[model samples]
Target chain A: MSGSARVLGVLGGMGPLAGATFMQRLTLLTPAERDQDHIPSILWSDPRVPDRTAARLAGGEDPLPWLLRGIAGLEAAGCGAIAIPCNTAHGWFEAMQEATSLPILHIVEAAADELLRLGITNGTVGLMATSGTLAMKLYQGRLAARGYECLVPAEEEMARLVMPAIELVKANRVADSYAPLAEIARRLVERGARAVVLGCTEIPLGIAAGPALPFPVADTIDALARASIAWAKPAG
Target chain B: MSGSARVLGVLGGMGPLAGATFMQRLTLLTPAERDQDHIPSILWSDPRVPDRTAARLAGGEDPLPWLLRGIAGLEAAGCGAIAIPCNTAHGWFEAMQEATSLPILHIVEAAADELLRLGITNGTVGLMATSGTLAMKLYQGRLAARGYECLVPAEEEMARLVMPAIELVKANRVADSYAPLAEIARRLVERGARAVVLGCTEIPLGIAAGPALPFPVADTIDALARASIAWAKPAG
Candidate 1:
């Protein structure tokens, strides 16, 4: 079997579109002049895995076992490392890593690192993600650890704006999601957030470019894609 | 490790976007109300596999070994069946099937089946693909076996329209590709093509849905995605 210099495994299908978005980002991010120069990847898009937010909030089945199986599949396919694009899934990150020796890139950690790299050291970073991600402090804890304050949607805003918006995206009503999500971004900026992190994978799809949302948006999937590329770089 | 009832392995990334598009179509085509109802898939998007067109035409490095490795990776990941999205890569379909005992879905055969289902048994089916696919008679031979005549781009059209359009798509200038490709589609319809198969994965990305081109367009990726879903259905 002729593997590339390195192969990055993608643990995805938290929602199938999000997984596809991650793969598309990988293609867009790479400096490949030709198709053959792009990264080699093995992706396990098993949408059969239980929903992470529902599993955490409503006494649904644990997604860990299914996630572990995905990791195993990637490993079996000879992936050197793995990356999961979903932010809410990181609630079980430690357990998934424990299940396998393969180095798994954390989405929140990658986003936080990207924020610091962009020189946003001391500002309030806004996070717009699934309720489960916010409830578990997925981005909050990671940003706080790096000495950055985090701002999130208020409880009412979450119920009224963020969560429903994510649902709309999952249901393939992406255009309908824009207004509510844009309002959430506006409120976050008003609450003194210097930049916003699209903590949920589907969030980026809803929000479009050009002066609509008046802050720098850091897409977590884009950060993870870059991290995967760096991780796949051959050792010196 | 837990595998789904049936895992369809994707041998992809002859061009990265095409592979992602195939995965997206699988998600779209399934009769799933929730995520878990969708099929599970393992994908090896190894763009590092040498170009199939260059190999066939100009005596470049054979992509067969890299392709075989991808197949092995899929089998190791416990895939019961496999699909390759690239039309040009179908040239090595038999060789890959010989390398693995797992059932592999053929994109050309799936498209041919779709043509019959559409009730276009005796008319000329137009094909728009890379020079390599055209040269190998990839679609022509399969459609002919099924008693359908295949009409490819004329040599002048291949050089002037089809080949350059595919390159523009590969270069991410999809919008620029639309006009030329639509012209080619117009010419094919004028030549008595009852339906046109977007034989190249990149072709569908170029043409838009509107009254510009009037022929029935059968997207090969869509046919392959449906075939994969059928292949993964649990036996009664």
Candidate 2:
């Protein structure tokens, strides 16, 4: 029917809150002056996808099939492209890409572009994400390729601070997540981090709950939103 | 694959911002303590659907076919039910319901339930909505079936206050929309309205831009969100 010519599909539900927030940000960040100017999108948020970290780190159930099913659903919905908001879920990025011909926007690349946009061109950028993401070096290898040194929380900090904060946000306890997340963020700054990349989709919401961070921070949700906008916009 | 058993389809994009906000409210309002506890949903937001007001009031292109296409897509994507957030768009509720076997949650019905929840069992309730929704009596007929007496803004008030405020919200000037909306809302209250139903999807966002209203208010976005949650929840 109408507006079906081009649609961006969002593969979400790694955690429902983060996925919904990504949709909201994508709508708000688009440079449209009217309703028609906004992007056409379909968000397929299924929260039952088994934990990405558990699948990646431990010998847990496979999530690739669930991810592929979502991609297939989005493709069947006539989406020209797809964007997945969850950072840990990106562990299946390559397999998902091969499963479908629709161009899937890369969240890590978007975060790297966001770092450049924030003028953190050549300094140590702190990363705050799930242990699965760190295990894969999703942000490390990409940011390093762009000439940026990346710093991540110590093992103890991730276990004590980062992971708990992420769980709080996922459990809908966003405000309670802010203190511990902000504490770890301050520790990163103390270690000479120029700025922090909120690498996980849920981390941005947790950090946003408290007072604004003194250090420059790039939210991966916002990064992915801008990337989605860029993909939706016609070339000049 | 994992959480795809019972997906809620949101037929949105009457105006992209309102639809996105509704999805966000749906996620936040759900009684979920964790990600998997939240509902599985697919939001098909296509802003290019011909304006419902233009189509209904001015003999413009029929948006029914476009609406049907979205519904079909959601069905194909394995959505067990549907929820359309826009009040004006709900003018086609019966036809949409006829088009699909999936149970579509009614925004007006949800608003009626919200009124009872807010202790407005028997009083004049003001309505703030698009002229198309007003013309179609989406709220008037439905709420009249209940005990509530409905009041609507006069023609001039809709033209000057309500309509422009809705446009400002769609155009993303949310903060700028608060004054005129509040003014008309105040006038409605002066005429003995116990509470106001923010009938149009965009109206809630416009009204939410400023300070909280001193009077009771019900937002259809939140109402629809609750309805979706109720549908997703297992029967006790």
Candidate 3:
């Protein structure tokens, strides 16, 4: 990567809408008086990458090679760093970082860091995401390493509430997501969660930050967007 | 471009949000039941490209080289077709198409084709866009060639209603853009426009397709997105 070029590579399309939402958040987060002041991004939105959740849980094809192709495309285009917005896809983060010298920003790590920044140290954070994300321990492992207790929905709730809500969001029926998601958040709060982390990108699209839930929600997309902005900023 | 590869190159970052929105629309518009079923896209969202409207109207730095670099990046990455989401930047569409053998999809041409598809032939259409788009006669030239009369805001309306609304949208205050734009639509309808073409990408972000406006609105982003989907589809 050239020292003068501050391009951010986005490794996206784990779900195409999540990837695009991340880009939109990045645009809104940047403090730009003019178009030139915003960060330059190389986005390879190849939705052909195999499904992450199905691959983790049900013997679907591995998405690594397709993801690697996207990473290489961005690297070849001279991107200095990379950000992947899909939370479930972080299962391959370490391997992806090893595949390229480009600094890949992890969505889980950013969310964990956000928990620390928000003064929620040593407390329980509720996580709402796909079964694969929980099964892979994407958030649990990171939050545990950071000395924070992670709370998740029980198996019944995961099957009956969380997964269905995520699917609804993927299908673009966001209005139907609010009630089920709010119920899950309320349950997490009853179990002593300080803040609910929207571990899935689709979660934020359906749920708004308001008084309907019992806890403050930390959106992983916003955390990742902030991290990307920081990564693209010029060094003093 | 190779005959086997079905890739879409996006020449974007002329107001990065619009570019991102275009990508999201493309993803939604594609008839994909699974991940790989969607089109492969290479997006170069380089915001440092010189401002198109400013360059056209105020003798500012030219945006063509930066645009060409984006197009070349896509082509080198194995893209078979290219789409640019910016409207004012369409002022250089012919020259850009000449610069590369890759098929370049035109926003105005797409809008005109969409109008015809909607049975809007031989009728007057209203245009709402930036001063640069108007001054360059971007929509009028193409629509006239396609045998349709185009109506633009008068100079006073351009200065008072259209340009300010565009600026507000650029600043991300899209909610405030509704009333003045509705008024413009009504005035254009009174002057004999059968439908309104949202020639600028930002207009759709601000104005919703509803019964409030006197004329039917045609979104250029949707038109371009549809054109891209057609371009990327496998031929029988």
Candidate 4:
């Protein structure tokens, strides 16, 4: 192997399962005939980092210090670039980027890139994320900048459908999460969304528990993995 | 989260998928209602480490320097203990343990512990692993020390069934690996083995791809995960 080869760093544990699944996806997605052909990676899964949504929406402990600590840990371990799998955690993307010279792959940017790759540029896209991500406009701002409009669930819908579904996944009741999440995505498509973006890390797991949705859904976990892969293998 | 909480380090990337799956298993197997309740882990998945089986069987590159490099990196990153998921890689376990104060969980010993946990204290247990592991006597010595006899595939079965099945998993052809592996496991059971140990990390994946094996199977991936989890949570 070349000494100059990039080692991908995953700053995860926003939800431990999401972090683990992202690592699994990264390994499965990479095209490798042998072990050495796959990406070299370091996953720092510190689930103790205070809740991202709680910090964003309510009066909760700030997770920025923990995020920075993880970044520092990865950098010290010789990571070339970093990828944070959690969608809501990207609320601190700028602060994290400012703290390190290493490039952090943005979950929102990767989702937007997925939208473009799916030929949905300049179209209205439905987004399913935590209430905090919606309140912070993480996807709305990024998608809007990329010429895509985001239609999100109403507050009542978030309370009744979205938030509980996310909790079910965190609690490992994935099969039960599918119904509520799928219903909301269907409602979004009915309200004129061309595609639905599974914005939160847990949302895709919920959606996948059921049969495939008829509508196009961009999974951010997969989107982030693809972005990490792209960054790992630059054109020769 | 307590500052004194243990951080589990994984020395992975013998084959990237196995390493990634181990992380998934670790997260899923842990008893956690939310992210904070899960274990904190660092996965150093540098797939570029030279082949362990090749090094053991043929005049191939020594992987000790690379193994030591990973151990050093994890130690520097604040890991309290380490777990290596690869069965073949443990051939250099003594050398690795000598280089680091951090406790590296032994996969073979973990398997032995798992066998006892399943109430199979002293009996004929079958082991399915890479040629290197068998050649190095990693499992035989350890299992014998634990008062258990291991029945392994004959040399012809190793070439015809076991090795190919393992390779299929490595090459991402998990579904195709099931039949051959199951046939061999059945043969072992017929030859007086009580239960089969899926000693190679990839074997469990292959077994899982097909219908459930009629015989009881000890999955080392899960064994290693359980061992890692046990180390992460100490009785108060």
Highest-scoring model, lDDT: 4
Candidate 2 residue runs with Cα over 4 Å from true position: A1-4, B1-4
Decide which is better by DockQ, 1 or 3: 1
lDDT per residue, candidate 4, A1-236, as tens digits?
12678999899888878888898888777877678888999999999999889998897999999999999988888888999999888889899999999999999999988888788888899999999899888988778888989999999999999999988887777789999999999999999999999999999988888899998899999999999999999772
Residue pairs with clashing backbones, model 4: none
TM-score of 3: 0.92
Model 2 interface CAPRI class: medium
lDDT of 2 by residue, A1-236 (tens): 23435689999887888888888788788776778878899888888888888888897889888889999988877889999999998888899999999999999999989988998888798899999999988888888889888899999999998998898888888999999999988889899999999999999999888899998998999999999888888561
User: Model 1, stretches more than 4 Å misplaced?
Assistant: A116-121, A208-214, A233-236, B1-4, B116-121, B208-214, B233-236
List-wise, what DockQ does each model earn?
0.56, 0.70, 0.55, 0.64
Per-residue alpha-carbon lDDT of candidate 3 for residues B171-227, written as tens digits (9 for 90 to 100): 666678777777887888889998889888878877763345545778888899999
Tens-place lDDT digits, model 1, residues B1-236: 24547888898887887888888788767766556766778778988888889999999999999889888888887788999999999999889999999998999988887777677776687888999999998888778878878888889999999888887766666678898899988888889899998999888878852344666888888889989988877441
Candidate 4's residue-wise lDDT over B155-236, tens digit each?
9999999998888777777789999999999999999998899899989988998899887788999999999998898651
Better of 2 and 4 by lDDT: 4
Ranking by TM-score: 2, 4, 3, 1
In model 3, what is the error at residue B23, expressed in angstroms? 1.2
Candidate 3 residues lying further than 4 Å off, grouped into runs, are: A1-5, A116-119, A208-214, A234-236, B1-5, B117-119, B208-214, B234-236
Candidate 4 - CAPRI tier?
medium
Q: Better model by TM-score, 1 or 3?
A: 3
Model 4 misplaced regions, further than 4 Å: none
What TM-score would you report for chain A in candidate 4?
0.97
Clashes of each: 0, 0, 1, 0
Q: Model 1 — TM-score against the truth?
A: 0.90
Q: Each candidate's iRMS in angstroms?
A: 1.9, 1.5, 2.4, 2.1
How high is each candidate's TM-score? 0.90, 0.97, 0.92, 0.96
Predicted structure with the largest TM-score when compared to the true one: 2
